[model samples]
Target: MDLDKVSFNGQIVDMTEDEDTMAVEAHVRALVLLEDALKKKEWLLLDREIEYEKSQELDPNCPFLHQQLVLNLFHKLQEVQLLKNGDSAGKTYVYPNPDSVNIFLGQSFWESKEYLEQWSRPGTLILAASQILGYRNVAGTLTASDIYAAFETWMNHNGIYKNGIYTCCGEALRDSVCKESSMSHSLLPYMNEFDETDLKKATLDILWDCQKKCLLVEHIEKPQALLAIPEFPIITTSLVQELIEKLKQVKFKCDTRADKIAYTDPRTRNIIYVGNHFWKQKDYLSCGSRLGTIILYVAQLLEHPHLFDGATKDITSETTVEHQGSNSPRSFQEPLNESIHNHDRDPPLPLKNSTPSNIGDALFNKSKSETYGKCKHTADTICAAFEKWMSHKGSYENESYTCCMETARHSVCNKSVMRSCLSELESRLKDFV
Candidate 1:
């Protein structure tokens, strides 16, 4: 026999020099020819039993050869049935049993070393498959039954059954519908259940909302003016200002107002009564009433001090006091006693040659060398950077500011001038709010 010119299924076959390579190639060609015969509907011309016997005799160890023969036999049987019943049978034709096909394919293809190698790193691959193919109960060795179960679950989860068929609702619409349906009516009920981390997240969320709404400023006289979430109650302006003061001391580590006495002081009773009247028209004082709102708005201002940048400029322009000898505004000088008592008039402006007490003075008045001796930059540069930092909204990391070459947190000037500037800003915000 001429091995190079041997013919099988009407196609010429070329045999290679290596015996093992020739055998494998011959088996692969036979499988491909069988698939081509099935696709071309040449079942009547092919003898199923004879072909199966031939494949077995040729390569009994080749699972693919046996699988192809079995599939060819199945198609032949279906063709026989169809021809016997004519056109009517074609209308009622049934698909191959998926479970049976799965079992056959798993045994013949998936069990092969090539396919097994694909799943060697199965964690991410299996997870991605499960998202589209449904969850697998076992990860080690997947069976035909496991695949069938996964398909069934995936169909059920992603499709609606109608007219004896499953119609898939795509992932996008499903996600949007799920989001819309899952929204909670109120977060207040869960407040008590929140741990420290959860409370922090909730507080941050509320502060972010306030920041967006521009409600974190000094004044919020009416509860109705705040964000209208049912979970948060209305608050009085006095309580809002009080919370701002407390937060200033806590957040900025600035000096507290001299007049700000403790809650237990006899002086606080009148202040409490005045604050109560502000919210009494809306609702009476109760436990946790408007407390959450108070914390939220206060946190927003403390967390985002840059919100006051525009207002700071406006305050500076309105309070600028020029000296006779120079065009520049002098340091503001307001006695602590007068500032504490004066509530009806506009805040005093910076005056030349006056003693420094508030933020205005700290900004215009030059700091002594002793006060800022540890600083690498000059006093003027530090003061300029401090003003720039007030207007700056970005992160406050060390070496972030180009002017001072250091951050306020690390600067020695933070003790005197920086501290006073923060305190003055808070005081000014309180006057306006």
Candidate 2:
């Protein structure tokens, strides 16, 4: 009935009558106003819109607008999940707009990311102030110690982000953010969520620069070629190194450490790569040769159906269906190119049919010579022992069959000492045969 309710769900109301139609126009107007306020980071106005919309939302449209509103309120946390729509690929689509990737953060942080190329940014500085000092409101009054304490609380609240930075910049920005944290002295108890937004924002600032400017247009495709994303993980060394010099233009570090965010890094143990599988550790966690496998899969999807099961395999085979694009195993419609084994081969000639001089006799004779102890006899001494060993199995025995075992020496005897043991029984058997 009002401007707010209509914006969230004016479409759902039947506007057949004149009064309802007037309400619909106001609803549309309200949504446009809401969208503009969100862009301005105007939370008060945005909150008002949400309150008005939520009071009467009995349908899906209201929830849709509400979700967008909530995300706008927390957009700083969102720079990490690129291309999240149902295949439109969002802003991270690498092929056509490969140069268009953007990390959503403020300009100061963006400038800081650009500045880090030449030097390290004070992570501890932010940790102390934005997160640690807990004194952004009383900014000038907080002592350095209090700030450090607050930063630790912040870091504790977040995951292990001693240096929560990995922008599009090509270099590493880690110069040690602090001399130390309160974790050492206990001035402030650690908070687990102190890493609210600055580090991620700072990292994005660097990322936007590297993605658009630092990484040369030519080199960009190669790194983006790694298609598999294991756990919304961080950037790669190749990405870091290639753009580091360009990032120098922005002052960002290339491979500076950050928590795996998706999981704890075993190397850093900040829960980097935590729930992620071990198979993709090299490909996704860092840039490596295996990432080519991802592109190969895409090729499989488009070019070579025979190369993939299509139904069973993932965009990346090890990437579970739940994790990647797949929802479930597809019904295998057709056999993937008939199996080479299906036609079968000469049935391996049954072990029972194997000659006494070959695998069967070899296994039999070898066992007998060892069990019966040493016997410095002729080739038949070994042969007879092998035949005796095989005699238990009707399949292994035959009138023409011979024994298999032999001591280490060329002699077929079982008692041959280690010193006399010269070569493998099969090799030694050739001379006797």
- Candidate that scores best on lDDT: 1
Please count the clashing residue pairs in each candidate, in the order shown.
Answer: 2, 52
**What are the models' TM-scores?**
0.15, 0.14
Report the lDDT tens digits of candidate 1 across residue range 246-331. Answer: 43332111112111111111111111111221122111111121223223224323221112211111112212111000112112
Cα RMSD to the true fold for all candidates: 32.7, 29.7
Task: List runs of model 2 lying over 4 Å from the truth.
Answer: 1-148, 151-153, 156-433
TM-score, cand. 1 vs. native: 0.15
Question: Least accurate stretch of 10 residues (summed lDDT) in model 1?
Answer: 179-188
Checking candidate 1 for backbone clashes, the offending pairs are: 219-433, 332-350
Off by over 4 Å in 1: 1-140, 155-394, 397-433
